[model samples]
Target: MESQELEFHTAEEDAGLRLDVWLTEKLSDVTRSFVQKLIEDKHVLVDGSAVKSGFKLKKGMTVRVRIPEPVSAELKPQDIPLDVVYEDADIIVINKQKDMVVHPAAGNWDGTLVNALLNHCGDSLSDINGVIRPGIVHRIDKDTSGLLVVAKNNAAHLRLSDMLKRHEIVRTYEAIVDGVIREESGRIDAPIGRHPTNRLKMAVTFRNAKEAITHYTVVRRYPSHTWVRLKLETGRTHQIRVHMAYIGHPVTGDPLYGKKCSLMDTGGQVLHARFLEFMHPTTGQFMHFEAPLPDYFTRLVDLLESRSSGG
Candidate 1:
């Protein structure tokens, strides 16, 4: 229950950067607004004195940060079932099923993976991602079923996050698309941003978008659908789904991007985070994980292959 502290020193290259901006940049998982709140609450001090969020940084200035213990009392742990793939002192890899929310949010404050992890790991989970997302490093969409690694401690969390930012963590997904991809493989390099008209959706657009790239190779071809494996070079929000849709091969059952009536009745996109490869954050050894497709996915693929084969 002790408050965690972090110290930072500015360099010549960091001169003139805003205090809040520098904090936000240094704390990879934290947002600028949250950093500003820390400044306003007097939890952030520059050179032993509280400073405004807009205070400009100078070379050799020392900045101290205090991270309060998350108000985690509100999060009650329930005995939710978990499909844990791998566990160590520093990390746990989970094979999350479809329709399972990864963390607590607006309408999904309970029955989330976080709640389940709380019950499972007790106080061993990382607190760097704030209260709701403690221990969570990266996230997949709620409807996406697949593998995700959770850090058990702060050191692991920061290292894993850095791996993701550097694209050193290799993530591969399995997906079924709405149409047949004639070519054996292809790549989609486009900028993706929030849909201008619909805030809830993402689109490939030039306006305030980030560079996104997805490379796909055909796994199998059906009459009207294609099974593919996708690798992300840049992991932006909804990068795979948005890029696939942009290339006219929207993931089947993707309510945000797919056709009104998909090839089948999947509750959501039939994409799974099938593979993860990265170095162990603590031990510095290579680690790899894979989660086989859920029952419904393989069953649907089998049925499609059957029909395509005139069975």
Candidate 2:
């Protein structure tokens, strides 16, 4: 497959930013993890020389990235059923299940939400995100089940992208954290970036970080766990998980940022994208959809509540 090349020149305002972070923001469709992969494979260059993902940018430096075509050209449609919340000519809101990768990446090249959308929506999905991520507007973690909207066309894709950037979209999530948060409600305003050493995980760090805010209200308190509802002010990679872990209450069963001695295991994290609110990209009408807590999540909550009450 032929690769595509894109170039960027660092401006005064871009100086001091990490290469992977800057390139990810510029690409818009790809993730920082993918960008870092490109850097590792020598597909990224600064002033025509390969550089590390964390290379600090200097004003006037020219950065070039080579985007390789997806592994498979003819992506097949899988006959997987989607728990669709809402569907229209322009968008599809899905209550994605846990263990389902949102898009194909690296080890996950099939059996993704995109493949399923290909089967359900067929040729109606948007191609603005290229071949791999057609119709995908945003993504939650594979282990994090939730509601996400997919665009069916280019016009819808553009408008929805704009709405996301402007924070016009509202995404509310419910998570079981490993602590009893005494406060009824609180806000976490911190910058999230790649962990200094882990590289695979995100952390609340000022270095090469982006602004992330999460507002959470304690729904219920257990002896060892707390149920909380959280809303995102900005969507950064693993923002909610990182912020929660930073505040000493990682989401229960989260393999990456969770506590080792978890109260219970629910296959993955006990987080669900429960509510989504946004304006219809094409219709100019208000739109809102909800996905109730998945059975697994509710079952865990029930067990936790029962245990807290000595049941």
Candidate 3:
């Protein structure tokens, strides 16, 4: 494993941006959390002085970052079943199930989609995201069942990632929210960042936050809940959940962001990634996929309908 060093000189346009936020935007294949860790480890400096992740940048300021090599991941190929929606030589679209983690992380080392892909695709997965997240181009929350596309090789991975960055990929979700949305359709445009006090959760924040947008349309209204379809313009972590919560209509059953509900048995947020549309990485052709709502989500909808009708 080798360490890499990067240097940047802040311009007028980059002024006022937080150090960790700017580095995450400028660096490829790295996350803000990872950059923050580097800062905490004293591997990031501004004008050769070790600074916090929240250090505001100034024009002409020199920033340096030292990225350590990723630790070797002892990932095991699991025989977990996958509901693959579509597959070709370049990519595989999966109708991921609820309660399934996308990739390996601190406490979740096995039974992830990556482990299954390793066994299903063998050595064909792209390594651009390293061993921990090979082939994963994007992710949904563990409780958000939905469609996700996995890249088989580096070329496909880079192209798909670029498409997401340009907002070219279409990702839509269906969510049962806690409140009845008065408007038929709306968009939530807000900046999102890690919560100031709670490092484990994300929130709508202006300081060191990234642009996030979510467009939603009410599909069915109940007395207390609303079924809505949401389209994401930016794929920030917890973007839809945070945005919806910010708008006071948090997704139902979202333990992290919403009040508990007895009408739903869902273990977490009642949000599903139901639609995906993108261009084929190798074929230069358009592709689309739709995943039906899981049993729990459907059951909740039925319950809501019954309650609305006084059944």
TM-score of each: 0.76, 0.77, 0.77
Model 2 score (lDDT): 0.87
Candidate 2 lDDT by residue in tens digits, 227-299: 9999999999988889999999999877567743345558667889999999999989998888888888888
For candidate 3, report its TM-score: 0.77
Task: Determine which window of 10 residues in candidate 1 has minimal summed lDDT.
Answer: 24-33
Error of 2 at 285 (Å): 1.4
Off by over 4 Å in 1: 1-73, 260-263
**Model 2 residue 123 CA deviation in Å:** 1.2
Question: What is the alpha-carbon lDDT for the whole of candidate 1?
Answer: 0.86
**Each model's Cα RMSD:** 14.8, 10.5, 11.1
Please, what are the lDDT tens digits per residue for candidate 1 over residues 286-309? 999999898768878988988998
Question: What does candidate 3's lDDT look like per residue over 142-213, in tens digits?
Answer: 888989999999999999999999999999999999888999999899999987754446899998899999
Q: Model 1: how far is 269 from its true place, Å?
A: 0.6
Q: Ten consecutive residues with minimal summed lDDT in candidate 2? A: 259-268
**Candidates, ranked, TM-score:** 3, 2, 1
Off by over 4 Å in 2: 1-73, 260-263
What C-alpha lDDT do the candidate models reach, one value each?
Answer: 0.86, 0.87, 0.86
* Candidate 2 TM-score to native: 0.77
